[model samples]
Target chain A: MPKQMSRHSTVLKSPRRQAGKPRPHSGEPTHGPLTAEELQLAVRNHSMPLEALRKDTTPPGLHYVLTHFDIPFIDTDHWHLQIGGAVQRSLELSFRALLRAPSITIPVTLECAGNGRSLLRPRPLSQPWVLEAVGTAVWTGVPLAYLLTQAGVEDDAVEVLFSGVDTGVQGGVRQQFARSLPIEEALRPDVVLAYRMNGAELPPQHGYPLRLVVPGWYGMASVKWLSSIKVLTRPYDGFQQAVAYRYQEDADDAGTPVTWMKVRSLMVPPGVPDFFSRSRILPPGPVLLTGRAWSGQGAVQRVDVGIDGKWAPAHLEHPPAPFAWCAWSMPWVADPGEHEVSCRATDASGAVQPLEPVWNYQGMGNNVVQRIKVTVGQ
Target chain B: MPKQMSRHSTVLKSPRRQAGKPRPHSGEPTHGPLTAEELQLAVRNHSMPLEALRKDTTPPGLHYVLTHFDIPFIDTDHWHLQIGGAVQRSLELSFRALLRAPSITIPVTLECAGNGRSLLRPRPLSQPWVLEAVGTAVWTGVPLAYLLTQAGVEDDAVEVLFSGVDTGVQGGVRQQFARSLPIEEALRPDVVLAYRMNGAELPPQHGYPLRLVVPGWYGMASVKWLSSIKVLTRPYDGFQQAVAYRYQEDADDAGTPVTWMKVRSLMVPPGVPDFFSRSRILPPGPVLLTGRAWSGQGAVQRVDVGIDGKWAPAHLEHPPAPFAWCAWSMPWVADPGEHEVSCRATDASGAVQPLEPVWNYQGMGNNVVQRIKVTVGQ
Candidate 1:
């Protein structure tokens, strides 16, 4: 027998801990401090390393991934995407059949709705993400609109619900991961049912055989591990759709649903990084600073690079596609001192990253400006 | 502008924390608790979920990854692996040339030296991993001995240093990631310079174009993003070699070098899991309990299933390869009650997992038995 296991220093001291009592999941926020449960979630679900911001389309493995439940393994041969509900004709398409359909490839950036949650003053007690919960990839698939038109949606259908094979208990409800999109949004030509990511078969972590690629929306809207689609005559209110991924001010508020991503930008930490602190240290010289920025509303109209607290407009390049992130750069002759480097993006619709993090019940849509600490040596 | 920023509950409360101080990294034990810096590393480098144990070969994305610095991107067309130092013939092999060399495919189980670091009474102030830092994969590559023999090693050569392109600062010293092996271990037939994993090009996070795969050794022995190899007449004392990854009793002790993984076993957590606690729930019935057991010293000899601390012998199967993990199973008839399910492994070398975690300065090799909490519902 292992000598009585006992060592959770933080959990023992935390006033919020219930100690052995299994609590049901809820939308309540932790008043202060991160918990052991949140730490477990943070380590299980990871964020993209900001260093990867150097690439255009994030290499598949480096792309950020989030699964509400465990990744469900799919045998391509045995998989069939069933499409039914209010449609005039139900359809079941195999992996090969979907690949043979009209294929279109495009670069799309996906950001998790809870990206900067850790940056919030009262950290959410879920995945305590600190930026980096975003990535861009080239996806190849059939236009979701094409499939919907083929099925001939009935006139009364108001929304389309997507159900993923991955299942788990959340808020005491055991159900498949499911979410819905209004009829108009589901009919967008660029919305895709993707089978491939960055020219490779979708990796299991990113939802193997098939998944929905909702361009311009936060990652939660782009469900993974696709199993079925149902055209609903009434609005869908599943656990994921109604109980989470919302912009709530308090527990009593039926917060507005989180949809398109807010404007955001991230800089590659400059110079050599410390193994633990990740603080940058480099000899003084002319250094090129670069990063990626984007928004779900539209193209990024401008990006500003800030040194310390002063801001300067940076050179921005057009993206490969309307929904993809754009590259931005600025040259700086760094002085010998400690400094903070940050970047902020403003989309065509004028949405910009908040200079400081905003607190919310579930900690969603926290597109706060990124700040990296660095030291320039002689 | 958003607002003034503030929050770090644990960092602020811990008496050991030095606010705003840029301290040099060291092997000093963090005698009491995990730190904010360790939490940062924990989330960046993830572990495989316990549920993934159900599979034979872990899916690539689910494989554990630990990068001390950044993942360097390699261009396959231009990359050449340089081989030099105490050798009669120096060689530089291109990616294409190496691919055409004699190939061998083998399944290897790799576990991190610090897999159970967080379990220590006083946690090591680095990536605070639990018991999930392990995975088995089928790797295809050219035999390392075949390449070493072709290059012709000199009689006086004592060790071989492997250099990876990833560069970072550790203990305030900046250098590329490097490690070495004794001449005898370097000439093993199964040691390989791998190019493919699970029949596909190694993903970027796992070291894209090329990497060294030393089967049966800890993952640190298999350098990722490998670029150069140098045969040495004397021991190499790089930071990674001399300072990190040592099994030290205290800072002053010239600790034994950490090498092969210790014996360990983990069960695939059965039934539905609570999203936060991960406590299991299942209907009462006859259930088959299964998991994987592996050791670098040799094959796993025995696996014992422990129900509420009572031990029972389990059925074991031969592994796919000598270096791969072996499967073990036991049948359990559950009643309507709560229980703690655990498993313990003993390797061919007669080394068995410790019942309780042993504390160390660097928190290396703490392979204590694994336990899971479950509830059998009516």
Candidate 2:
């Protein structure tokens, strides 16, 4: 596990790091300590390996783990969920109490708002992500709607704010991790306070005691290690809610808040060389092309593959679970030559992956088309 | 169940009937009789209702069923798989033997190569199809690879042909429904001889005793009610193989043969009025849009949703099973007015759904983008 201290100072220093100069800390954090293994897995400058996308189902341990600061170590016994503010009744529930409440399981893909940030041209200097900050899992927990109903939300309540246990200074503000949603969205039945991931108790890095699983939204909305829920009469102005995570087109205007994930597709790079492997040349024959496509707002409507410039449809496989990624494959007759293969995804909402990513200050939602190169041999 | 007689002569007369004129039999078959129910379900001039695409998972019985002639009643007790030709030894495996063989389950989407035929302009006079002839299912049975290995294919074997018990006259040839694949494809692990669908024994209309399931190919490659497997030293020149199902640019020249599915998408129409329905007028707010997309040649790379001319990416849900269609959704803010919504699919192979279908003689593989109309109320 890695931990960070002097959270506020780090926040103030982020801008200096963003000035396109080499990181002052020389690729090492001055405040946080990371184990060799933890440092090895951190999202420094690399994307999730393209080959990982071919997995039929991502295992929990193997699932990609990403965070803004450092992994917080929380003691489960001391953890509690406090529901207060504009609600008719304020309630404090322990971990056991949450488990005793009515529960449901849903499969959802959680993607960091900056999953493809590194690909954006003139890249922003924040936490550099490159398409690996996403994973799908079956979350089991009590529906947040049930908890809200039990707390007796008042009509005056306009927004629901969730606060997590992780404390850090971000965007020059010292604060606990928090985000808010409109009251109507807070009550969606599919939104849950998950305590388990993929059938096991949630992992420590993922949020052991409890976390908010906001389906169809970017991972930012899913506040991990959740601690408190406040029914607010006014819009939430938490640091995470009103400042850092907001997507701005320019410095002078208030930009749209990053929410659901944009439509995107990534193809698993086929047959590349490894340390023990000697060749990248594929024997001439029918090649099975495969990958995963997803969107935050809806189900994947379709995905198209391109070889150089010629395009064709690929066979889409049924998703193993709802709200999970659909696996797809196509058989390509390998021509003996180098080929640039690409994949594009379209969501049911009619949104297609852009060939070039839309650049933004925060580098949120860079869902451009993905392409890879491969060679076929005689 | 529907049944038809005069299997052979009807096949011979098909070309004469296909010669650009109103069906000479006035929608009634000149050779065989059709039950009233079968005729009613038969596609006349419409595509599968766009509403059907909204289903998260198509129920087994509700899945679309299409056939060339009639549903052949198969008796499991008497059915057996005969494997011969270019093999060291011939093998006759009974239904029981097949059940006892090593088996695996796979989820796959099967689409008629002619699914969008009726949508093509100057519509070719043939088995009219407008996208309904496709469905996804969980197929369970013995791997075709195991059977191929058991028979011990000879060194010179080049092609593998599968024959179904569905005997009928098609394209002027009186024969059983048959298709062939290159030897490499026939040995792939994913190919199976399926006897179960969605966890139950195969339905009569969907090939009861056994069927061939070629995961990434068009439905035509999956011969229904499979009866025999023949390994050949050259390409099998069956009528269905050498003649029909071929794509032709002009009527005079020999056209390229059609294989695998093209990229395509269909939207489940949202909210329509009926006697029991209270209202189709959606309360003005964020509407969740959803649908499924697929391809035969490769995995769907992307799906784009368009409202009039405005397009945005929809969030895609994780696929529930392998080789099944991916469900996708998007949040749309409805404006009060009539709107035309459309979805286009792009496959991993770079094939995109055409705005207008490419007209062909046989109307094979018309993967035109689909559009629908909807109204939003204040």
Candidate 3:
């Protein structure tokens, strides 16, 4: 009498496959089977695949998920996060009023409103996401200026709005996706609201019950399925703070004045080894030449790493947290086939990393200069 | 004897449901039921589900597909396209010289390069894409300034590149995506190279043996699996023109710009008879609100529509051909219950549509002011 377990046919599966092969879950496995150094640190896209560590920390099922619409639950006793337009006390909060306030943590990295759009030169309509998007995590919460000074804001406010319980269908309209920040960067003091991650409690796909960890920027300005903020003395026409998070022409001309531009990234710079080009050539000894450096603005002073164009001083490693991401490495000595290795960085405010940036019809602030092309042999 | 031929396994199946309620393909198509004029366009994702005489003009397989790194197949005598750096006549051609040049067709619409990041707001990682990304077609080819004047671009070039034969593994960077445009939007003239599409001949998931068709922008500038192009005097730092079609900070900074902004859209403001928070109440008199009006920049020319905020006047049509999409409409007069119904447009260079627009980071060009909500009774 114990053999009646029939519930495995929920139906609907057509992800399509036989029209030229390759399409079963289109590269399936949203998790599992990694390790080649955990697939090069979960090759970005929400980061944390480095083999589910435990001490160097990173396991929350390998943190780094970043979603928006799909994963939305919200009934934590009728959820709340409100805040209110232009402020002067329009509060709301609850998730136990932001877990009883005064909290903190850090270690950021988010990225992806499209990440390396499969190297778009003219290919932009979308999706080709070259870098899996990106990730890092740690997080925690509270601070949004201690709840925007317990909702006091006003003084010609300027914009804060966040809103989310996720709902979509844009273009055909039916929106609800929202965003907005500048109330002095939402009263910074390390702007947060996150409900903890990496140390636990905030997992129903990374925005569990609350979110808004804006440290530097990118990661679509960190807003996840949050709920509401509003403060604006102007600038809040919703539908994602007025026509879905904007950007306008000029990386080469779609026109300009679309605004929002600054704080660029994409690094590699260090010493330049693995076949550093002049057309490749490497075969004499030890090498490493690693990469990765980030920023929304400030902190990252000096990274260099060149090869057939000079410079290679090296020596930096402060980032384990603080909007996280620093990893440098640079040790060389070779000489056989073909090369080119370049890298660059300089932020702390000085900003450098351009061989050509500033073109905006939406190729938004691309740091530039980071080439590679190894070949070396015996 | 023809009955002995039964080999349909081809694998794909699965859309049949009933046991646990997993249905969601609601792109509706019933038939074993429904007959009040087939329940009026049977609405769901394209709407109509009631009205009359819309005689299915391109609604069969439900149009709009868009793929990208998938769908390859080349070999048109080794495919080809090339073009070359700094130019002065480098050319490559093949695919029978891109089907013997001089073509034109028109029709346009393409979309998807992450079309409206699943309606952002705070949910911005990406790909929940409900508008299935748009389509229209009619393509054909040539132009791109006659292949940059048959690859003779010099005069201090200023970027062009394209290269595609698609490759993958982005973050660990096996790389190959490629993109670039600059040189006056790659010699505009509505940019081309397409190889045909609504007039057939392309579909290997669209991009068959050649592709490019830029038209106005977005569609990742239109590159598909094309091969090469190069030209540059400036922009083309690769990685999709420097870290994937970007967008960034500023817009007063609540933050979003991962890249590409401005030229918003979304005014599906017609006959909305449903959806309310501020508008809809029609049905007992005369109606017609209809929607859709585009503009990555230029060409919409008047769409207006309103109800409670009062305005009306709409009417735009004519765009099923060049760069496609125009469609507006307006005629309200029922007035009963809820009502807020908005819609704005104006283009042909006068710009307009902005009850609010200036937040950027990566919700690329989201035209604002589009509302809808309905409820009328006796």
Each prediction's total of clashing residue pairs, residues at least 3 apart in sequence or on different chains, is: 2, 72, 98
Better of 1 and 3 by TM-score: 1
Candidate 1: the clashing residue pairs are A2-B355, A2-B356
Q: Retained native contacts per candidate, as fractions?
A: 0.59, 0.00, 0.00
List the global CA lDDT of all models. Answer: 0.82, 0.66, 0.51
A228: Cα error in model 1, Å = 1.4
Candidate 2 lDDT tens digits, B33-102: 2222222223211123334465554444335555554346677788888999999889999999899999
lDDT per residue as tens, model 3, A192-299: 888887666775556677888786576666777688888888876554443333343322221211122223333322221211011223355777666556565666
TM-score of each: 0.92, 0.45, 0.30
- Best-performing candidate as measured by DockQ: 1
lDDT of 3 by residue, B55-94 (tens): 1122211233333223344668867777787887787878
How far in Å is the alpha carbon of B343 misplaced in model 3?
Answer: 19
lDDT of 2 by residue, A178-290 (tens): 89988888998989999998787786557767989888777888888888999999999666775566565544335556777777777765654211111134557788888
- Candidate 1 per-residue C-alpha lDDT over B1-378 given as tens digits, one digit per residue, 9 for 90 to 100: 001111111012212323433222444555554566776786678888777888898878778889888877789888899999999999999999998999999999999988888777666678878889999989999888898899999999999999999898887788899999888889999999899999989988898788899887789999999899999999998878777876666554455567777778999888877676677888899999999999877579999999999999899999999889999999999889999999999987767887888677777777899999999988
> Which portions of model 3 miss their true places by more than 4 Å?
A1-108, A111-188, A192-213, A216-316, A328-378, B1-108, B111-131, B135-143, B146-188, B192-221, B224-316, B329-378
TM-score of chain A of 1: 0.92
Q: Is the docking of candidate 1 incorrect, acceptable, medium or high quality?
A: acceptable
